[model samples]
Target: MQSLLKNECSVLVFTLSGLNETMENRYVLFSLTALYYPLIVFCNVTIITTILLHKKLHEPMYVFICNLCVNGLFGTSGFYPKFLYDLLSHDHVISYIGCLIQIFVIYSSILCDFSTLTVMAFDRYVAICRPLEYHSIMTNQTILKCILYCWLAPFFSMCLVISLLSRLTLCGSTIEKLYCEIWAVAKLSCFSTIVNNVFGYIVTLTFFGHAVLIFCSYIYLIRKCRKSIESRQKFMQTCVPHLFSLINVTAAFMFDILYSRYGSKNMLQGVRNFMALEFLLVPPILNPLIYGLNLTIVRQQVMRLLFSRNKCDE
Candidate 1:
């Protein structure tokens, strides 16, 4: 009891042990991250800028793509900057409050990805399935509401998580992950974390429900598009990118989930690190590339923007 009280009161910092075995290669890792992080920023920013600047691309689909890119930036920001810093530092530690903030930013951004994709699936459903009512149903105000739902829902969900986390009395101050994670921190709690665990499972089910919803919608879309070449082309042009992005994000999230729940100390740290970093590394860069390069109009507009900027420089 005395030790518990002392631990509970003294837990102010968390030592991150994920990098302990990989410090020998820190410089090489830091150099690569420095290069890769900027590339992610540039790609997402280019997609966002192209959508915002062109009046013709102001439709719901483009706007949602822009929101997606913005979210990619938001989510990656929660991890990459701090990760780069940690790679160079001898001590890998985070404050108690910092850990909570990291958990909120990282996890909320992930939930927001699901929310945005859910809204995008709905938009595609309306556009392809109910073509006549596409404009009417996806009015500017409605689009605004969808965007708000994407952001606000995740924000509130994570807020509740952070609130619950703050109430726990932690007996340990070491997290075994590269970044502060909610489950990792919760595992350190001195008492039962049944509430947090239940809530976490609920949140997981809700987001995976989003995936199921998107899959069902795509089934209907595939059936409807099969009847007409025009609709088929539309599906190929638009829905394919969204589908690819959904699959990529889903796979990455699954990797992290599996790693978090089943990863063992006996396993190699590099493989474990790869699993944890997959979502952060791939989805941010891949989302923009998938959308920008796959969508004709977005590709054309990006090229035109680059050419025009070059001409101005000349």
Candidate 2:
């Protein structure tokens, strides 16, 4: 029995059961995802390219927005290709290493979203609250450090999580969700996952604190802006989009976290699937649109680029 259990613990490939009941609609789903995934890619890519090519749009806020879009592409790439493949393939199995990489990419991207937003909020605060010090404080070096934090913090955090997950002896080989997630993988462990849970909560709380700080800072910004029309306009133009993106991402994360931790098994599979996929679906499409359309400079630059390309084709 002990040897058999040991053999079972050595799970090399994990079966993803998230698509089992939805297989009948595979072709329909595939068609939609095939159409939609590229749109997500294009939108994010356009924003990234627009920001990179135009020197005038290279401010701290635009740079952060560009980073957000890049992270969108990064996160969605981790899920969409595999998901599109699974929509057609009968087997929804992933190798152990592949699963770990997917988790790292997707979750780290999510964390990067929060980190970038935190820095963007700070940029706005300085630009509005202490206008004189804005350029000095948000120097090229500062922006680079902020970008590093956006990526490296999540990378190291997930490294610890994947390490913890790799150490566990998984008793099962099936994951219920559409993609590989830390919690889903951890739940398969044969032993108690108290440490993993603790560490996961620690990360969660730390980011939650970020959200809180951003909110508080924005409130102060709002109060300060009320006295000046220029500040008010800037807040509406820039901060509103950030607020919208924050709300969208926050809601998406909340849904996934709640569903993963406390979702009822009796719930419909479609509902479960949507809850799991909301973050991936909504944010990638939404973030780019929010920034590309809302920021006047980016919008003008994108339009100019499109016109120039068309003229070149002629």
- lDDT for every model? 0.92, 0.92
TM-score of each: 0.98, 0.98
After superposition, the stretches of candidate 1 with alpha carbons farther than 4 Å from their true spots are none
Position 185, candidate 1: lDDT:
87
Give me the overall lDDT of model 2. 0.92
In model 1, pairs of residues that clash are: none
Tens digits of per-residue lDDT, candidate 2, 182-209, equal 8999998888999999999998778777
Task: Provide the global lDDT of candidate 1 against the true structure.
Answer: 0.92
